[model samples]
Target: MVDWIIFLPACFALNMACGPSNLLAMTHGAKCGVPFAQKAAIARLIVFVPMIAASALGLGLLLTASPFVFGIAKAIGAAYLIWLGIALWRSAKTLKSEEFLDKSVSMKIAFRTEALLAISNPKAILTFAAFFPQFVILDAYWQSYAMLGAAFLIMEAIAIFAYALGGSVASTFAADKIPVFQRISGAMMCVFGTLLLMAS
Candidate 1:
């Protein structure tokens, strides 16, 4: 049996952690719209389903033991983040308040970006492997694992909504400073990418 009493709060904390993925949600929300951002966020959740399953199947342990694989994964993720940041930074120059939500970034691009980011983060697999086992019942392993995965996805959705809403609100609050918001978001993403690269 899963321990809901202990699991729920921990799940919520991980879901709401200030991370690059959540930042991407906020950035998308601010740049496009809440609805668009929410839709884009779905891509990550879709990818995470397989990730959680892989963790349950012990791929997470493989990643933990394989520093080469982990390094490669982080490098790819970091490069993409840096490129995305640079693109956003450049786009900010031409972003108009009236057409902010109608800018160059397409739905397809957003979905791909979200999916790639989720897939390339090996740490996510480690997180699931390390965290989920505590609540999982060995007698009902698959069932409990599936339940925890479901709970995680639910919390992730909630966190996505919250971050996207925050970005939308911030966009509204700084309606006149859209360019500034873009620049800040871009810079933050770059910093995140750099930090990811630096992480050992």
Candidate 2:
């Protein structure tokens, strides 16, 4: 059986790879004077949990059917990351006041965006497939799988919360210099994307 302890670090790494957008989103909400903690918590519970569950199950089945499919998915994900990285990096150059507008974004929109982002990430899907079954004993499907999935979800929630809190703290420092900070954060996101693509 796979050691449960190892899954925590794996989940953390996966979150670190895909967490920039979530951090940025929460920071944007915070800038608009929205309560980021509550919104972030809600986003995880209402959106991330279900998405992770469905994606895990679906990807698990897909990998069982054809392992090669994951390679293609990883390539696609890498390409998408590169594209996103470039866009974020470019936005860093053209920082504008309107970009940080306090416009109200609905919970539904936040939930949907997060869900789509998490689902489309090949790293996330691959992680679920590769790591989840490690804990599952040959015949003890229910116990092991449930524990693994639950551990992933809990780790994800904690990591997201940490990211949001970090964003909030960063925002406080950049309150008066929003544009500059946006550019810096955007550049950081680009770096993250580049790393993800290279790793893939």
Q: In candidate 1, list every pair of residues with a backbone clash.
A: none
Q: Against the true structure, what is every candidate's RMSD?
A: 1.6, 4.1
Taking all chains together, each candidate's TM-score versus the true structure is 0.93, 0.68
Taken over the whole model, the C-alpha lDDT of each candidate is 0.86, 0.58
Q: Which prediction has the highest lDDT against the true structure? A: 1
Candidate 2 lDDT over 61-177, as tens digits, reads 575367477566555655655565566557647655455544454556556545545555565555666666666665776566666777766766666666666655665666556
Best-fitting candidate, scored by TM-score? 1
Instruction: Report the lDDT tens digits of candidate 1 across residue range 1-200.
Output: 68999999988999998777888898888777788889999999999999899889988777777999878888987887788789878988987876785545699989988998888766577679889988999999999999999999999999999988888898878877878887887888788889989988
* Deviation (Å) of 75 in candidate 1: 1.3
Clashing pairs in 2: none
Off by over 4 Å in 1: 103-105
Model 2 spans with C-alpha error above 4 angstroms: 1-6, 9-22, 25-58, 61-68, 82-109, 195-200
Candidate 2: minimum summed lDDT over ten consecutive residues — where?
29-38
Cand. 2 Cα-lDDT: 0.58
